[model samples]
Target chain A: MIEIKDLQKNFGDTKALKGVNLTVPDGELFAYLGPNGAGKSTTIRILTGLTKISKGRARLGGYDIEKEPRAAKRQFGVVHQHVNLDPELTVFENLDIHGQLFGMSKAARRARIKELLDYIELTGRAATLIKQLSGGLKRRVTIARALLHEPGIIFLDEPTVGLDAAIRRRIWALIKKIQLRGTTVFLTTHYIEEAEFLADRVAFLDKGRIIALDTPANLMAMAGAWAIDQFKDSGMQTHYFKDRKQAAAFQTDDSFTLRRVNLEDAFLSLTGKKVQP
Target chain B: MINECLAIYRREMLILKRRLIRQMAGQAVSPLLYLVTFGYAMGDKIRFDGISYLDFLLPGLVAMSSMTRSFAIATDINVARFYWHIFDEFQAAPISNVSYVAGEVLAGMTRALMGIIIILGLGLLFGVHLAYGPMFWLPILLNSFLFASLAVALAMLVKNHADQSLLVNFVITPMAFLGGTFFPIARLPGWLQSILKLLPLTHASKAIRQAALGKPVNLHSLALLAALGAVIFLIALGCVNRARD
Candidate 1:
C-alpha cells in the first residue's frame, strides 16, 4: 500500500530522515519503533504527506505523494499523536465535519457517525461536547474521525499513549479488529507493549536510521539475551550465555525449561535502554 | 477548487452563526468602548480644520476597527495549527493548496467584515457620520478582505503564537497609528507625508474617511491601496509556501 525510497528530509542543519527506505504491504500491521528523536515520527509525517521531502519518492497505493497528493491522501486515514478534536463541537459533530471534509453526504455521514460511535463505545456521549469527555474517550473519537472515509490504510502516530491499562487493551483490541478488515496499519508507538502486541513487523530506528527490522518475536530472539539458571541441592546457579540463540537452542528436558523473550527485552538489548514500563 | 473554498466558507459561517451572540458580543463591545472613550469622553480640545475631535476621532476609530479585525484574524490562524491541528489534517488530505489558503482567508474576511459592519451600525448611534450610499460598503469590504488575507498569511509564516502577537502589536498597531488613523496626515512634514502614502492602510483610511465625510472618492488612493494589497498578499503567500518548504 505504501512505498518510500531514498527518503532524505532535512530541517535546516538537522537531517530528520536520512536516506530512509521502507515498504508496507496492503493488510499488514507494521510498527515503526524507536526511541525519542529516532525519526519515527518524521517517517510517519512523510508517509502522510504532512512534510516535504528534501529528496526522494513516496507512493501510496501507487499514487506519488508529491505528484498526486490528493489521490495519495485519499488512500489513508490518519490519527496523530496529539488529540486535535474541536472541544466546542459534539462528538458526533466532530466526526460529521470530518466526513463532510471528504465529501460525504449528510445521510451517509449520519449513518457512519453512528457506526463509529458504536465501534468506539462513545454512543451515549455522542451529543456531548468533546471537552466533556475523558482523555481515553477523546482519543477514541479521534480514531473514529479518522475512519470516517474508510481509507485503505490507517497511519496512527502513537495512538495509545497516556491511557490506563484497560483502556490501552481495549484500544489495542479495536486496532486488531481494524487489521482484521484487511486495512494496512502503519503506526509509530513509544509504548513497547503496543508494538509487541499489535505489530506483525517492527522496525527499530535510531538517530534517523533503521538499525534493525523484523517481527517482534524475531527481534527478541535476535537480541541474544541468553541465560542459564541452574538449581542444585546446596545453592542456585545462574549462568549468562554469549548469545540468545545459544540459550534458546540449549538442551532442555522435563527437569528444566528454556525461556522465551518478548519485544521489551529485545528493545533493551538493541538500544541499551530499558523499555517504558 | 472554488467549491472547496465555499465549503470552508460555509463551515466558518456556521460556527459564527452557532455562536452568533458570542460573536456579536465580542465584535460589538470593543468598538463601542472606543466610541464612548473617543467620541464622548475625549471629544473636547482636539481639532481638525476647526472641527470637533469627535468628528476627527470617529473616522479614526472606524479604521482602527478594520485593522484590528485583520489582526484578530492573523492571530487566530493558530486555531488550525495549535488547536484543531487542521493544518496538519489538510496537509495530508485531498484538499488543494488554494482551498487551504482560502479556508483561512474566508474565515478572517468574515471576522473583519463583522467588525466593520458593527462599527458602521454604531457610528450612527454615537452621532458619528459616514457615506450614506450602500456603495460605501465597496471599499470597506475590499479593505477588510485584503487586510484579512494579509493577516492569514502572517499567521502561516510566524513560527509561534507569541511571535504572531508581537507582529500585531509592534507592526500592525504602529502602522494604524502612523497611517492617519487617529489624526490628519496633512499635519505631517512633506517627507513623512510622502512616506505615509506608501502604506496600504494610509490609502485605506484616505478612501474610507473621504467617502464618510462626503468628499469625492480619491481614485489614486484607491488604486494605491489595491496595488499595495496585491503585493502584500503575494508576499504573504510566498512566505507561507516557503515555510512549507
Candidate 2:
C-alpha cells in the first residue's frame, strides 16, 4: 500500500505541487496521468527518497518515506523514466549489483536474478552489455532490474514512453502479469489508451493537482458514452452525449465524426486541455 | 553497512577487472618513462643524501603515483554520473551515504595499491632496491586514503566532465610537481617551502621517502596524514549525503 497526505513541493518561488493527496491500495495498478511539468517526476522522486519532501507525509508499505527512508526504499522498487542502468555492465551484473545493494545473499541473488531474467523474457540475453541491447530490450532489462529484490510495490515512471505500439502492448502484459502477482504498481504515463487499458484506476493530474481519480471506466463515463468531433474554422469542438444515437443525431455534416468517448476525451472535458500538450 | 559497501566496491572492481590489462599498461608507461629519463640519465651523478638518484626518484614516484592513481577515481565517478547514470541507481538503492563513500574510497585505494605495486616491480627490473616494509607502505596507504577521499568529495561537487578536468589541471597537476616528487621541498626557498608544506602530498612524499630510505620515520608527518585523511573522508561522507538530496 501507498499513502500520501497533502503532498506539496516548492522550487524557490515556483509551486510545483500544491497539497496533492492520494492513496493506492495493494495489488492495484494505478496510473497517474499528467501533462509535462505536472510534478509527476517530482512526486516520484520524493517517494523514492531521491528528493527531499517539502511538506506533507508519505508512506510505502507502512514505512514512512522521510523518517524511515531505507525501509521505505526497500518496500518499493522504481523504474525511472530514463534508462539509468550501467551501460558498461552486462545484464546479469547490473541485476546482481542491485541485489547486492539490497543485501541479498550470493545464492539468493543468483536464484532471483535468474528468475527475473526469465520473467522479463531476457534469460538468454543475460551476458549482453546494456549498451549493446536495443532500446526495447534495454527497457525490459531495466524492468527486470527493478524487480530483482521483490519489493511489495513498484513505481514505474513512463515505462513504455518511446516504444512502438506492439512493444508497448507486450510491456503492458508484463506489467499486468506483475500486478497479478500481487505487487501494487504506481505508473505514470502520457499514453491515455495505456492508462485506460491497463490501469485498475486512473488519476488525471494537471499543473500538480489531481483533477480526477477513479476507475478508468468510471472516469471515461464522466464525459458521457459517445463523442462527436466537429472540425470548424475556429478549431475542433467535441460534443458528448449519453448514447450513440444522441451522438449520431448531433453530427450533421461531413466535418463531424462520431465515436465512443475515451479516457483522453474525459480528461479534456474535465481540464479543457490535452494530456500531452 | 559492510555488505552495502562491499557491493559498491565489487562493482568498481568488476569494471576494473575487465580493463585490468589496459589499466596496467596505462599505469606502467609514465613511471617507466620517468625511470628511463630521470633515473637512468642522472644515474649515479645525482645523489640526494648519499642515496642513488634512482633510489631517491623511485620512492618519489611511488608517492606521486599513489596520489594520482587514487585521485583518478574522480574521472570514473564523473563517467558514472554524466554518461552511465549509474549513480542514479545508487541513489535509488538502499545504500547509505557513508557506505557509498567508504566503498568508493576503498576502490580508489585499491587502484593506488595496484599502481604502487607496478612501480615497485619496475623498480626491481631496473635493479633499484629500497626498503619494502611497513615503514614504507604505511605512508603510501595514508597518501592513497587522503587523495581518494578528496576525489570522492570533488567528484560530487563537480557539475560536468569539463569542470572535473579543470579541477585536475588547477588542483592536482600543480600539487603533483610542487609537492616535492621530482625534487626536495627544502631545495625551494624557505617561504615557498612553507607554502609547499601546506600540501598533503608534500607531507606524504617526506614521510614515504624517510621510511623508504630506512631513515627514522617522521611521526609528525604520519600523524598529519592520518588526521588529514580522516577529515577528508568525513567531508566525502558529507558531500555524498548532500548529493543524495
Off by over 4 Å in 2: A233-235, B42-45
Interface RMSD, one decimal, each candidate: 2.1, 1.4
Kindly report which residue pairs in candidate 1 clash with one another.
A224-A244
Cα deviation of B42, candidate 1, in Å = 3.9
**Best candidate per lDDT, number?**
2
Model 1 is docked with a DockQ of: 0.45
* Candidate 1: segments with Cα more than 4 A from true spot: A224-259, A275-277, B14-23, B44-52
Could you report the DockQ of all the candidates, in the order they appear? 0.45, 0.71
Candidate 2 lDDT over A1-277, as tens digits, reads: 9999999988888888898899999999999998889888888988888877789999999999889888988998899888888787899999999999999999999999889988988878889988899888889888888888999999999999999988999999999999999999999999998999999999999988999999999998999999998999999999899998888888888999988999999999998998976
TM-score between predicted and true chain B, model 2: 0.98
TM-score of each: 0.89, 0.96
**Global fold similarity of model 2 (TM-score):** 0.96
